[model samples]
Target: MTTTAPVTTPKEKTGAETALADSWRVVVLNDPVNLMSYVVLVFRKVFGFDEATARRHMLEVHERGRSVVWRGVREQAEAYAYTLHEWHLTAILERNETD
Candidate 1:
């Protein structure tokens, strides 16, 4: 039988390091153009959030005008932001911060 070597993660290598030392942010912004119901629906359809969670986020957008919806690796965050844009929502990617 063939054997494979175990894989090690970055966090495993650097025990004291923060995971987001190299992570990215995905921000979704509010828009007057989209209906509230549509925003909730899109959040649910795109991120698989339930109605309550999606509605909460949509409400946050309505009140605050923007929200950092997700955080992860840069490439993934950029991809997600782009996907949200394709869905006609405003989105952006930024480097995650420790502070």
Candidate 2:
């Protein structure tokens, strides 16, 4: 008797899976350790935001416990979160539930 190999094919992603894959957010949380000015500066440097825009995000993080700084695909969101962590900022990745 001869044995035959089985073929395998890649599966397509479902709508929910595709939505989840495209939904990610990078958030910065306020911490007593870092100065507000520093956070603003970092935001500007990392995201190329203008002084006003950076200050706006900084204020959001300061007043509100956290701020969603960026939203995009998982890889880039993770990268931004990691980079912020490297900068000694309180950053985290979150799933965008609305997606």
Candidate 3:
């Protein structure tokens, strides 16, 4: 009779799994420089948000001082933040911090 230890293999994450694991948020901060209409326009242009949706997010930023405009993988979040910066809007990336 012989005894042997069982081997265990580590699971590898697929692309979708990795993306879900690395979720991020694109938050826009309220600023004194840009007008509300302009912010709405940028949101529409950058994200293809409809007028009502754009205004909703714009209002959130205006009233709350910040709004999370988008949530997705890190790369897309970074791209959105960069584009918002180019449009002169204050934007940042934050980890999702939830499952």
Candidate 4:
């Protein structure tokens, strides 16, 4: 009698699945050009962060030299970084390894 091996199929990922699989972060670096209040305003405008939240992130950047302003898929993270750069804040994207 002949035996046949079981067939296997690769699963496809949807947009959300792919996004969740590959996480990214948008980080803002401290710069002398932008005031803390300006950074907070940008955060509020770009990210819709509340005043307290914006201030918290601004303070983090001030004391730590860098703050992770957002975390999500690469596309969104890149967009956020670009917006921050346009606002004259130093920003960068990094892969989120924790997820």
How many backbone clashes does every candidate have? Answer: 0, 0, 0, 0
Candidate that scores best on lDDT: 3
Q: Model 2: residues >4 Å from true position, as ranges?
A: 1-20
Candidate 2 residue lDDT tens string, 1-99: 999999989999998888787899999999999999999999999999999999999999999989998988899999999899999999988888866
- For all predicted structures, in order, the TM-scores are 0.78, 0.79, 0.81, 0.80
Give a tens-digit lDDT track for model 3, residues 59-91: 999999999999998998999999999999999
Question: Model 1 compared with the native: what TM-score?
Answer: 0.78
Q: Highest TM-score, which number?
A: 3
TM-score-better candidate, 3 vs 4: 3
Error of 2 at 26 (Å): 0.3
The models' CA-based lDDT, in order, is: 0.84, 0.92, 0.94, 0.90
**For candidate 3, what is the TM-score?**
0.81
Clashing pairs in model 3, backbone N/Cα/C closer than 3 A:
none
Model 4 lDDT tens row, 24-87: 9998998888888899999999999999999999999999999998999788888888888899
Worst 10 residues of 1 by lDDT: 11-20
* lDDT tens digits, residue span 17-44, model 1: 4565758888888888999999888888
Superposition TM-score, candidate 2 onto the true structure: 0.79
**How far does residue 45 in candidate 2 sit from its true spot (Å)?**
0.5
